[model samples]
Target: MGYFVPVEPGVNLFVEDINQEGSKTIVFIHGWPLSHKQFEYQFNILPALGYRCIGIDWRGFGKSDKPISGYTYNRLADDIRMIVSTLQLDNFSLVGHSTGGAIAIRYMSRYSGYGVSKLVLIDAAAPTGFTKETAKDLLKETLNDRPKMMQGITDTFFFQYITSSFSDWFFQMGLEAAGWSTAAIIKLLRDEKLDADLPKIDKPTLIIHGIHDKVIPFAQAQELDQKIRNSQLVPFQYSGHGPFWEERDKVNQLLTQFI
Candidate 1:
């Protein structure tokens, strides 16, 4: 796919360019600890449905130039803006998940791109009073032993995503998916708070959350649904934070409707 979009100096905004001639653009933003790779199902499936899907890898993740700094929501938002402007994209949609959702919201609140028309939050992350309090305490225990912490997060971060096929392969996969320092990851945990910016959003919004989401929980999704004025919440009966990953067919179907 010719993925090329630089967010800023020293911060490479990673992108998976699906089409240049498609009618409308649907940019996919990935979550913390995951890069554009997370949108594999959508990137490959949605284009068949006549939607241009471009998944972006934030500076510290994916194929982008991962500098030591520039992992905050503000910096990440700037990276997204750069991708949009650099590509000259218009009348587009943004599907962001987890931390990526927070990044999209930051972009919407700050920079309304030339043609960004719709926004979808797939278990999207928002401040709405959600905190990385869990991460904070967890970080303390694992700061001195990242590999041990990474081992512990194998399931918590990915659910029953563990397996013999991937086996220990998925271990490092989780670690480098979105390259970030402990401080940066902790910073993202804190950035999930969006109370000050949700009301300012002006685009049509779709909030999809799994009923069984243990990572972000359903209440946060409910709070997001209640807060976003033009937003609608779609409950996935059996899934977690990465419903799109767990249920691509369903997620793509709803995305088709939403976009």
Candidate 2:
């Protein structure tokens, strides 16, 4: 079922909940400039295996409310907290990709990993995101020619060959987000520090990262594995930044085994 859940006053987040009665539950948080739609493949497959999959679109992205503020990591993490509390979710697996992974990190630290049992970070942008100079250029590009910037992101998204239609669809997802939200997230990627948040995660973590990822380096995954106690690192050799899509079957297998 798909519905909007109010995270705060006048701000409702779009949530896609599948197999509501399944025994296991997994909450998926998407990357920057994208929404819950990023996990379409997972939703299609995971729910069939008796696992409930919940995908949430962050505010200002996807079908969620696009507010001008609340772009900070703390605010984003709080938004997630409200969702978990409202749904009464407990002992669920939390899967986050890219920026979503960073947000998950903040959630683990800020909320003490409330209802989460296991954590999965896919090519997560943690420990650090981007340098000041790169962030400045990205923000400027987003402001000036957002489409071009998104297209560039799509080009480097996957190492394997993706059809033109698939590429267009992925590119469109990025464009669906608000410009301010996109730029603000870029700033967050540059300034937000998750060094302190790493060691605080006590849940078993599965760090899946692409060896050829250009967006967030593979080293970041190594750092995360090292910092987070009781964590395992699984490298996706044939994928890039988007291992969920590039190596979907392997990712699904890993998730199945881990969860």
Candidate 3:
């Protein structure tokens, strides 16, 4: 089932909830320039395995409300808190990818890991550092020619072969997002640091990172594994930045066993 859940005044996030009566619940937060749709592969399998899969389309992406403001990690995490509260979700596994991983980290810290039992970060972008110049150039490119920028991301997003039609579908997902929101998130990625938040996560965490990930270096995952106590790092050797799709079967199996 899918519906809009209010996060703030005039701001409602699109949520896809499946297998509502499943024994276990897993909440998915997608990365930048994408939506809940990013986890289509996982959603297809997890639900059938008796896992309640909940995916949230961040505001300004997917079918969620698009506002010019509130792109910061704090507000983004707060939006998730509202969803958890409204749904009365507890003892659930939280999964996040890319930028969604960073937001998940913020959620863990800001909300004290409320109602979450296990944490899964897939090719997460946290404990990262980027120069201001790089951020500025990326933002400029994003605003000036988003198609080219998105194409570049799509080109480097995967290590495995993706069909032309599949590539087009992925590219279209980026286009569906508001341009301003996209740029705002770029700034957030550049500016925000989750060094302090890492140690605060007390849940049993699983960090799944692709060894060949170019977007967020493999070292960041190493840092996350070292800092987050009781965390295990699983490297996806045959994947790039998107192991959840590039190696869906392994990811699903790992998630099933872990969660």
Scored by Cα lDDT, where does model 3 land? Answer: 0.94
**Deviation of model 2 at 155, angstroms:** 0.7
| Candidate No. with top lDDT | 2
- lDDT tens per residue, model 3, 24-72: 9999999989999999999999999999999999999999999999999
Candidate 2, 48-105: lDDT as tens digits: 9999999999999999999999998899999999999999999999999999999999
Each candidate: what lDDT?
A: 0.73, 0.95, 0.94
Which of 1 and 2 is the better model by lDDT?
2
Better of 1 and 3 by TM-score: 3
TM-score of 3: 0.98
TM-score of each: 0.88, 0.99, 0.98
Where model 1 places Cα greater than 4 Å from the true spot, the runs are 128-133, 157-162, 166-170, 177-179
Ranking by TM-score: 2, 3, 1
lDDT, model 1: 0.73
Between candidates 1 and 3, the lDDT winner = 3
Backbone atom clashes (below 3 Å) for every candidate? 4, 0, 0
Model 2 has an lDDT value of 0.95
